[model samples]
Target chain A: DQQVKQNSPSLSVQEGRISILNCDYTNSMFDYFLWYKKYPAEGPTFLISISSIKDKNEDGRFTVFLNKSAKHLSLHIVPSQPGDSAVYFCAALVTDSWGKFQFGAGTQVVVTP
Target chain B: NAGVTQTPKFRILKIGQSMTLQCAQDMNHNYMYWYRQDPGMGLKLIYYSVGAGITDKGEVPNGYNVSRSTTEDFPLRLELAAPSQTSVYFCASSSSEAGNTEAFFGQGTRLTVV
Candidate 1:
């Protein structure tokens, strides 16, 4: 079973606009959510993260919003730039699973100029 | 500082062949993990190690083996290669400070089993 899911495989947004990527999870035991950005031929880099206790967390242009009631989380990038185009993956930490992280299928975001 | 390093960036193996993929971390992390990513699929855990001499299987551990002899090294072995095993493998490490923490990943190894 897929504990974490990102239904949208791809997304497109114009530069200077906002880019929103959504993710959902079925396991309630997950208390921490993280987002990673991956570029071609390179490893994924951590972007932002949010704990279950917080509804939102912001860092510069990146923001993560978590909703326990909906079992969902989203990454928002305001004034998106063309360099922001890449594959975004959302992962959840299974609090009881020895630090094993469950990652979503990933969403390919395209920021056009 | 080369947080995480994986050797053999690309390899091609024939069916029934066996080979080992090397991974090492200079961060002295106690937790290390091996994951494989298939086309259009999310990363799937293959194996992991909490510390030296302690290893555990992950979601997809069949046909694969791993050893954690030292905190800095974790190697994955493929007993007998299969076409289904063709995928990109990634090695990651993280500190044991908390349950929820970011992991540092290597560039990745692309393996093709023909």
Candidate 2:
């Protein structure tokens, strides 16, 4: 079973606009959520994360919002730049199980110049 | 420093053949994992190691084996290659520490079986 799901396989947005990537999870036991960005032929890099206790976390141009009640979380990139185009994967950490992580299929975002 | 290095970035194997995929991490991480990604699908864990001499299977461990002889190296072995095994494999490492659970992945190895 896929505990984490990214329904949208692809997304497109204009440069200098907002780009939002959504993720949903079925396992309520997951408390830590993370977002990773990957480029073509490269490994994924950590972007940002939030805990179950917090509703939102922000870093510069990127922000992650978590809604525990809805079992959903999203990554928001404001004033999106061309360089932001890549595949984004949402992951949840299962700390109790020796820190095992569950990841979504991923969403490919294209920022138009 | 090379955080996580996976050798043979790309490979093609014939059905019934066998080979091993090498993975090493310079970060001295206690937790190492092997994952495979199929087309249009998320990564599935094949195997994982907590430290030297301790290993366990993950979501999709069939047709694959792993050995963790040292903390710095973890290798995956395919006993009998199959066409369904063709996919991109990724090696990742992370710390079990409270604040450093973020995983670092290697570039990945694309394996094709024909």
Candidate 3:
């Protein structure tokens, strides 16, 4: 069963516009949520994370919002740039597991000029 | 610091063949993990170790084994290869701390099984 799901397989946005990626989870036990970005032939790099205690976390151009009651989370990048084009994976830390993480299928975001 | 390094960036194996995917980290992290990413799929944890002499299975642990004899090295072993096991494998490490759960990943190892 896929506890974490990224319904959209891919997303596209024009450069200098808003690009939002969404993720939903069925497991209520997950307390920590994270987003990672990956380029071709490279490993997934950590972007940002939000603890269950906080509803939102921001890092410069990147921001993550969590809605525990809705079981949803999102990553928003304003004024998306060409360099932002890549595969994004949403992950959650399993509560019972010892720092083990579960990831979503991923959403391929394309930022065009 | 080289961070996390994984040897054999690519490999191919026939049925019943066995090989070791070696991973080493320079961060001196006490926690290490091995995960596989199928095409168009998310990463699934195979095995992880909090420290040497300790290993545990994760979401997907079939047809795989791992040993962490040292703090810097964690090798994943495939006893018998299968087509289903063909995927990109990643090795990650992090210090065993609450605020440091963010992981550092290696370049990744692409394995193809026939």
Measured by DockQ, the strongest candidate is 2
Q: Residue-wise lDDT of candidate 1 within B1-114, one digit each (tens)?
A: 889999899999999999999999999899999999998889999999989999999999999999999999999999899999999999999888864388889999999999
Cα lDDT tens digits for candidate 3, B28-95: 89889999999989999999999999999988999999999999999999989999999999999878
Q: Work out candidate 3's RMSD over C-alphas.
A: 1.1
Per-prediction DockQ: 0.72, 0.79, 0.75
Candidate 3: which stretches are off by over 4 Å? Answer: none
Better of 2 and 3 by lDDT: 2
DockQ value of candidate 3: 0.75
> How does each model score on TM-score?
0.98, 0.98, 0.97
Q: On DockQ, who's better, 2 or 3?
A: 2
Q: What share of the true interface contacts does each candidate keep?
A: 0.40, 0.60, 0.70
lDDT of 3 by residue, A11-71 (tens): 9999999999999999999998999999999999999999999999999989999999999
Write model 2 residue lDDT over A1-113, tens digit each, in one string.
99999999999999999999999999999999999999988888899999898999999999999999999999999989999999999999867677688999999999998
Interface RMSD of 1: 0.8
Q: Which numbered prediction scores highest in TM-score against the true structure?
A: 2
Task: Give residue B105's lDDT in candidate 2 (0 to 100).
Answer: 97
Which lDDT value does model 1 have at A74? 96
| Residue B25, model 1, lDDT | 97
C-alpha RMSD for every candidate: 0.9, 0.7, 1.1
